[model samples]
Target chain A: MRVLGVDPGLTRCGVGVVEGVAGRPLTMIGVGVVRTPADADLGHRLVAVEQGIEQWLDEHRPEFVAVERVFSQHNVRTVMGTAQASAVAMLCAARRGIPVALHTPSEVKAAVTGSGRADKAQVGAMVTRLLRLSAPPKPADAADALALAICHIWRAPAQNRLQQAVALHTAKAPKGRTA
Target chain B: MRVLGVDPGLTRCGVGVVEGVAGRPLTMIGVGVVRTPADADLGHRLVAVEQGIEQWLDEHRPEFVAVERVFSQHNVRTVMGTAQASAVAMLCAARRGIPVALHTPSEVKAAVTGSGRADKAQVGAMVTRLLRLSAPPKPADAADALALAICHIWRAPAQNRLQQAVALHTAKAPKGRTA
Candidate 1:
């Protein structure tokens, strides 16, 4: 499976593509950041983000898009921007009918580093080692993106089974009735 | 001027269109809400919002788009959705090259009712009076949307002057120098 992971931010949205399935070696296809000027108008900034994300989608053609789920508990000042950028990334993928998944920060960290509380340096180091790169990707956001993709790839099997079970249960149940 | 206003929300996005400049009789061109199923995926909800906003834009051909500015200080559970919806609204307008303006709730209330802290009912009543409607727009969100458009129309003149002044100052100032 191929997945695109995004660490969404208004100033610097990190995106990385990883190709693999669970219990297999994953390959990092590409990783980069989409940047918007802080001084630009919000509308124009969103447009820029959309354009950048669209370009990435065109180039990568990943089957799934995984974005860091934004939580309002973060820095109040930056949380909104994170939510907005994530929305754009999700929209771009959903518009293309690519399944979109949201993984929390801790989930990403835990998947890659074996600890939910792993620091940025650990995540960077782990991503570098897992991808067989000589150095960690620049800008912690890029490393975080790769970690998110790795997490999604590792977790997809169970998630897919759970989804199938739910679908099967719903399909067998009576129509239009609450469970 | 014609302006389309949006009060962004995940479940119920209110939209309104108003026509006329400041200090003159204004016309309520349209007012309504765009709804999305709460159970739908976040990405699909955003796509629905984009389609809804685009439809309003297509129908009204508004010269400007006005959207409510979301603040994280509000209900924590809903603020993120509001931010995401507002982002989609802004993105839709920006993609069409329509000038987008964000008005705070207090600003909309103040523009119509002469008090920033005016209640929703008061703002709705004023919007009814300003537009000469027989009744307040249904759903407080709808009224708020109309209020936003009215505020944008009323504020445009002063905002334009400020923009022009800033532009003039920047042009006359030395290049590569901070203000």
Candidate 2:
């Protein structure tokens, strides 16, 4: 399965695409961020965002989208922008018949770092180590994107074979069966 | 000044780069989306996004970045993913020394449509018409990015002499500074 992980923002939004299941990993496929100018009106910025997303969709055509859920921000404007960007992502996926899932920051951190409160540098270092790469991904956002992807992998049904096995067992046992 | 607009997402984050002096017409430099798979793990997806965005930054190198503000989503999972994408954008710009700006959807819509309640198609069509393009940018996300750039332009101090004048009048000449 292919999943796209997103770190949404108004000026810059991070994105990552992964395809693979446990015990095997798929290609990085691609990664990048969309940019918008300051001093330009908000309308123009939104236009830039729409354009970037469309091109990415044409390129990747992911089956499921995973996004990070926002909790709270000290800055209201920032929070609001984050929310709208989030909506934009959801909008893109829904329009394409793709399923989108969100994970909280804590959840992603825990999934990737084994601790929900891991800091950016820690997570970045861990991501590099986990991926077994020569160097850490440049820009903290990229590392966060990787964390999001890894979180989805751990959260996805495939990772929890116990549930699947139980489901299969119940299915084969016929109606009203419990495993 | 040139501005880059972004619409954040997991699979496809839309982007538009426009250049213009304050009060002058904004010109499109490039517009496209960065994409990744939906089912792949979060880590892989983020890598894809980073790579794609890096390419865009290297290719265009806008002075500023603008993005849609993220809003709340009832679905916990969806919101989380969107937030992550937003952060990715911020990191991208920060790394490139480009200042990033965030704007709400309403702000973007109002800048173009004069109404915060404008729908996607309305905003899209208006953006196309404003840019005097042959067709509306494909995909609503791209159109939104264009709208964001337009919004920044509309709100720019150099672009709106009247607003600047009002501000000057309101400031009461600022402590004997030269006129």
Candidate 3:
């Protein structure tokens, strides 16, 4: 399956597409960043982000989209912008009928580098080796986007099975107050 | 000026439209809530919000859009959802070339009820009196939306002048080390 991963941000959003399946090699389809000037109006910046994502979606045609799930940050302004960008990514995928998955920063780190505490350098090194690229993608956001795609590609199969099992169990069980 | 105000929420988004100028009586053009099922996927819920806002913009043709600016909440999940919904509202307005303004909850209350710490009932009562309605609008969110529109209508002129003054000063100032 091919996945498009988005590292959502207001000033610089990362976009990367990877084609791969579980237990198989992956190919990098594309990677880039969409940037909006800090001085631009919020609405115009969002429009630029929306247009950038739309262009990437049109060109790569990924089956699934992965976005970084925003968590609480000390800086409310930064978090708000990230959340806004993330919603735009999800909107773009939903408009195209493409399923979207959200992965936490720790989850992506663990999946890519085998450690939830892995730093940027470790994650970048792993991504370079996994994709067999001579160099890591520029601007940490680009590498981070690829890592998100890799994480989803690796975790989705197991997650799907777990979801199926839960669904089956719920179907067979009766409504109860028990925890 | 015509203004569309949005009270951003995940489950129930309040939308209202009003037409008026500063120091003049206002007319309520529309008021309603857009809802999405709790069990629905995040992407689908956001899509519903996007569609709802798009429909309101198309129907009302408001010159400006006002959205509730989300602040940090104790509940991270709730705040994130609200922020996402707020982004969708801004995006819709931006796409239509309508200027967008964000008002804090306190700002809305102060503009309508003459107090930043006014309660919901007080704001609702003031909205009814200002709009010449027989009763308060249903759902607190609806009242808040109208309050946001009223706040923008009253504040925009002063805010615009301040912004223009800052721009003029910057344009005439030299790039110097002095503050």
Candidate 4:
């Protein structure tokens, strides 16, 4: 499967595409960052992000999109901007009927480096080795994006099976009872 | 000016439109909520929100769009969902070139009832009176959406002047030099 991973941010969003499957070697299709000036209006910045993502989607045409889920952050402003960028990424994928997955930072770290507590450099090193690249992707966000794609590519099949199991169980569940 | 106000949420997003100028009576053009099932996938839910906002923009064609600025919340997940929804609202407006403004909850309360700490009922009552409606809009989100529009309509002119003043000052400032 070809997965496009997005590390969503307002000023700099990372985009990377990887083609791979579980228990197999992966190939790097593309990697880049979409940047908007800090001084730009919020709407204009968002427009630029939307356009950038659209361009990437058009060119790479990944079957799956992985986005870094915005979790708790001490800086609410930063978190809000990240969440906004994430939603845009999801919307872009949804509009194209591409399946999207959200992976937590820890999940990506653990999947890429075999440790949830792995630092940026460790994850970068692992991603470089996994993709057989001579050097790590520039800018931490780019490496992180590739990690997200790798995580989803590795995790999606198991997740789908779990979901199917849950659905089947629910289908067999008893009817609601009143007190 | 005609303003479309959005109170963004993951499950139920409140949308309202009003037309008026500062120091003049306001008219309510539309009010409703866009709802998504909780069990739906995040990407699908976000797409629903985008479509809902796009439909509103097409139908009402408001000159300006006002979105509730999400603030820090104790629940990180709730805050993230809200921020995501808010981004979709902004994207809809930005795509249409409709000027967008974000109003904080306190700002909306202050604009409607002359008190930043005004309770919801008080704001609802004020919105009812301002709009010449017999009853407050159903669902607190709906009322809050109207309040956002009212706040923006009253504040935009002054805000524009302040922005212009800052722009002028920066433009006339001395060039780079050692202090």
- Sort by DockQ, top down from the best: 1, 4, 3, 2
TM-score each candidate. 0.90, 0.49, 0.89, 0.89
User: What TM-score does the predicted chain A of each candidate obtain versus native chain A?
Assistant: 0.89, 0.81, 0.88, 0.88
Per-model lDDT: 0.84, 0.66, 0.83, 0.82
Best by TM-score: 1
lDDT (Cα, tens digit) per residue for candidate 2, span B11-116: 6777777777656666777777777677653434544555566677778887666777776643555655555566566656644445567788899999889899
DockQ of all models, two decimals each: 0.26, 0.04, 0.22, 0.24
Clashing pairs in 1: none
lDDT of 3 by residue, A1-179 (tens): 88999999988898899999988999998998988778866776777788889889988998888999998665776998999999999988876667778999999999999999999999999999999999999888999999999998999686745544443443322211100
* CA deviation > 4 Å runs, candidate 1: A161-179, B161-179
- Taking the tens digit of each residue's C-alpha lDDT, what string does model 2 give over A84-117? 5565665566445455678998999998789999
Which candidate leads in DockQ?
1
Q: Among all windows of ten consecutive residues in candidate 2 chain B, which has the lowest summed lDDT?
A: B170-179
Model 4 lDDT tens row, B82-105: 988899898777666666788899
Mind giving the per-residue lDDT tens digits that candidate 4 earns over A31-123? 888887788667767777888899889889988889998875757668878989999999888766677788999999999999999999999
C-alpha RMSD (angstroms) for model 1: 6.3
> lDDT value for candidate 2?
0.66
